[model samples]
Target: MRIRPTSARGGLPPAAASAESPAALSGPDGRRLPASPRRRRPDLAALAVLLILGGTAATITLMLNGSARVSAIRITRQVTAGQPLSRAGMEEVRIAGTGIDYLPWSQHASYAQRLALVTLLPGTLLTTQMTATASEGITPGKARVGLALKPGQSPAELRAGQRVQIISLPRQDPGDRTTTVLAQSALVDAVSDPGTHGPPRLVNVIVDAALSPRIAAYASNGQIVLAYLPAAH
Candidate 1:
């Protein structure tokens, strides 16, 4: 028998043994192994932009819903105490940031024919504290009376919502010309111009009901004069 040259372990050639090694067995059909899939990194800049845009959109939506304006009631003309509130004397104005204390325009019907508690100027915002019903103007044991006074009888600065003292001047008799205070701290409800050449102006005031008879008597004789009280009092 003829002896053939072989490798020590498997009786194969060295080149053939190397080709069948474990490294070559890892690939299919003895081809090179494909490179592992590359790991992907997150784009931080793009993610930051997306987050900022989302926050901006949320803020804009909140502003549009919360900052919307509505109509409120405001006086267009002067409103005196004890006078009825009419729609003609007021207007609806669109305003922003209105609070709960403000009166809305839709509630004007309830305030119509209501008496104003104080003197309301033009452009004044109507409020619940500014108005009342006609019966609300009269207090317990008090009555409302009207006085017709000449130009010189009342002070030029006397106006609605003012406090005054009704003084009874002495007649042209032999007694002292000292004046007597008939009523003190009387609330002036309203004042009106005669709108003509020579008539006296009318002033309505609230006083004790017991004094109504005496005040009417003095007013009939034109012996009553008005004295303005200090605002602080």
Candidate 2:
């Protein structure tokens, strides 16, 4: 008798069995329909591409933000009206460009002789219009005058950067007791700290240049008073 090799488990191979009855989708008409395509699996190559794109977008955004900033000048200390700017009182800071007429750090030296048009607090961003370059006064139309006011001349709670009205009290020379308004809208630049039996309170105010000469003369008589004018600035 001749020996012959049979298939494993005495059954048809996988290929021949599958070919006998192929897998297919059945339609409503009892006909075969096409099988759907196999779904694809995610791979590291696609993930790597996504990560690269994200990093590029972040880098571009950082560059655009950095390029939009510019260097400007900042005051390091309090500078009163009519006070000149100094090299040690200024520093450079970076800010987003706003297209305003702000003072640039490179031109800080040019503002040394110029006076502050208004009382500048610390950490202030300097601007071109805040300085008077033409004269020793605070501004083209304003002059800063220091008045030694008596205790009752100004409010005890008066502070700097406040608006006030300058009035002159009548004297005994004539029978006139009328009060005079020297300045309607004056800016208080600086206020001296009070103390016990100390010197008179020295208040610095910026008023019109035309009234400066007369105000300084009248203030020496100790008859001038500072009337608080809120919301006048």
| Full-model lDDT for every candidate | 0.79, 0.79
Identify the runs in model 1 with alpha carbons over 4 angstroms from their true place.
1-5, 11-13, 20-65, 68-101, 104-127, 130-136, 195-197, 230-233
Model 1, range 1-233, lDDT digits (tens) per residue?
98766788865787777777776575465666778999765798789899999999999988986677778899887876656677788889877754657788999888866767788888998889998764467788999889999878887767665668999878868676888888976777778876444689798888899988898888888889999875430
Model 1 residue 100 CA deviation in Å: 4.9
lDDT of 2 by residue, 1-233 (tens): 97554557777765665556435324563464678998776797799899999999999999998998989999887777645667778899999888887798899898865667788887999997788653334557778899998788898788665668999989867998999999987777778967536779999998999999989988999889999874311
Question: Each candidate's root-mean-square deviation in Å?
Answer: 8.6, 12.3
Model 2 residue 7 CA deviation (Å) reads 34
Give the best candidate by TM-score: 1
TM-score of each: 0.53, 0.46
Query: Measured by TM-score, how close is model 1 to the native structure?
Result: 0.53
